[model samples]
Target: MTDNFYMLTWNWLADSPLLAAATEVTTKSDGEEGTFVLAGVLLSLVIIYFASKLGGELCARINLPPVLGELVGGVLVGVSAFRLLVFPESGSLAEDSLIINLLQSTAGMPTEVASSVFASQSEVISLLSELGVIILLFEIGLESDLKELIRVGPIAAVVAVVGVVAPFVAGTLGLIYIFGTPVVPAIFAGAALTATSIGITAKVLAELGELGSEEGQIIIGAAVLDDILGIVVLAVVASLVKTGEIQISNIIYLVISAAVFLIGSILLGRLVSPLLVGLVNEMKTRGQVLLTGLVFAFVLSYIATAIHLEGILGAFAAGLILAETEKRKELEEQVVPLADFFVPIFFVCVGAQTDLSVLNPAVPSNREGLIIATFLIVVAILGKVITGFTVFGNPNLNKLAIGVGMIPRGEVGLVFAGVGSASGALSEATEAAIIVMVISTTFVAPPLLRLVFKETETATEAVDKVQE
Candidate 1:
């Protein structure tokens, strides 16, 4: 009787003035809402570019990786700091975003519809951030020397395999046993340790004039292979995270599918390379080569996503394939502008979404996360350092240099953190811990690399003097 009365009363009031006025107040025209969304996005981009460039410039000036600066910049502007670039996934409300606030306060954006606009703006920025990573992987694929990688195969393969397995095992088991972290999150954090920042390492080597040295070649080759293996591991772990349960059959299926996707993409891509070149050559129009290259990359990225794999993997494979073509050099040069424009967005966004409050040791609950970060840092350093000794038959080789070169996690580590966070596979503590580990390893490795190489050089000088 009570329910019937309420239903009748509600139905009677549906067309009443009170309900009509309430709906009118809450609702806005689609055009007005879209305009607000665009305004919010534009303002956000302005912030992103400023932060990325500012951070990158400062880091570049100080001899650290410019990428590190970008991450820091993001933190300063993100949830932990100014609340400038907050996201919904990182436990932030739409009102928490200063951009949304600015839109309403300045642009006559209706307060009732502000939440919708914030969501729309955030979704667009997130998409752009993802695209930035895809381009980054593509650029990495182009920079890799497939032919040289093959030539240096045996020793490089050993180093890469050891580099991956050691940290992965150590970090995963340590997290599970010591911290009592769940299996999937533990695996994800462990995988973050397995990345070697080829860009950072290569830059350091070039500065030290070791780019062509035997150890350098070995490091280069191993890092390239490390990237491929890391991608596969990411695919597998990310798949496990999505399913929320790990079955042996599922693992086998993901592994097989990843392998088939990468290998088939490469083989088919190589065959299609000639046709790509032919099409580009036939076009007398401007921008054909660059446009065609991007098309191939996007298409592969789509295919990868459709198959429940990472689109970045497809983009990387696309770069690797196009890298084998006659236009490889030209395509590489052309892609740099795009990379410069988009890649920082990904790095910055990773930093922005990270909540560093969990790193505070003062909070009793936060203590475990701090300990986890420290453990990961130790494992990350030691794991790759062990890979240095994996090389054999080269008594003169500076094994320490090889190991140190693989230590910096750099951009690749951030990729793992981003994916883990996005998938809701990591807790705030674990995510922050992973981010801390990445930053520590990245900053620590370059100076350590320099020190190890210096020792090797000094010892060589002493030996030469004695022989003389």
Candidate 2:
């Protein structure tokens, strides 16, 4: 049976036209390397352009996040079933064959070259992803009214702290005790749960017309702090992993750096606003200032990487700084096209990395994989929900609603999962669990939030009637 399986796999490999062409090219030099490189580049661009448009249309039709569509497109390409059904290559096309052969040959290359190429590709993808995230953050900052956050200060603080603490503790304990995973994996699992997709929650609030309300302000403020705390936890975990000790000095440094970055960015934004406004007014060159702003963002992101902080952190800081400028609206308008082009790439690449074949339910009965996934999901849900009870003031307000509002993990969670998997800190099973957690969180938030907001509105109307 084993031999038959091997034979079948070999036959499939041999019959692949892509594999055959790649071998012929490498062996006989039938085509120029430049031609192959150009073809690869064009293919990637074509895939990205059409997929993004198709995904956007599908998302609008289904009322789903456009990101969801991008992911679906990636899955269609990466998954075997989709590839077989759609492309249906019978191993004849040289272009397809060459690509397959090139990938296989590259896989067997010397460790250094292979690693270097992988790292280069990963870095390019990451840079594009960071650019998308920066633009997203800038939009968030531009839309935010700081006065609203200040009005809900105490409640926001309580919610943010609870949101961070509960998830970290529950996730760590669940992984360690329930799944019996190692301490490092448990730490990473816990860290993954800490990110709250402010974007998702804010979108829901906006749709319901609650975005300008007190509860909305509190949720948004808490989300900002939640993100800050999440990154701190990640840095702490990474430190512990590398040194086998959670260095107090390192923690202090990260905290201080984060504080400085946040505070300084806001201050700088305010101070630089007049000058930026003048420059934009003076230049009168359409979109040139926005281009400069992008360059600044990249510079800050590079600096953050140099200082051992995440590039997105620097990107966010740059966005915050730019937020206070009078030209924010114009900048946002100019940046949207670039964001739209690159953001889907990030989502698609993430989806491509997910191999669903490992998720087969029939194999490995009592399946440790399924068990871990279930355990992580429970922890992910319950932990975030606990934050609702942390509301310090206004007992009448639904703190549970606020907590649930912060539940979706989104892109940041995927970043943590990818980092851990790449570093070999997380096994395939654990990575799958994290991915499931992200998907669940994304899918569950909007409907849950709508229901909670409806209840809140009904209660408010009743109170108003009584007062009248």
lDDT of each: 0.83, 0.67
TM-score to native of every candidate shown: 0.79, 0.75
- Judging by TM-score against the true structure, name the best candidate: 1
Clashes of each: 0, 5
List, residue by residue over 1-468, the lDDT tens digit for candidate 1: 999999999998996899998778557467789999999889888899899899878977876556667778888899889999998777788889999888878998888888888889989999998898788768766766656555667888899999999999999999999889999899999999999877667656755677667788789778866876787788778878887655566557666776688779988888899998999999998999889999999999999888766787788778778888889889989998998888778778877876777767897766766778999999999999999898888899999999999998976897899899899989878987898888788768776877788899999999999999
Q: What does the lDDT come to for candidate 2?
A: 0.67
Question: Where does candidate 2 have its weakest 10-residue lDDT segment?
Answer: 84-93
Clashing pairs in 2: 17-91, 17-97, 18-96, 18-97, 22-98
Badly placed stretches (over 4 Å) of model 1 are 1-28, 175-245, 394-402, 408-435, 442-468
**Where is model 1 poorest over a 10-residue stretch in terms of lDDT?**
143-152
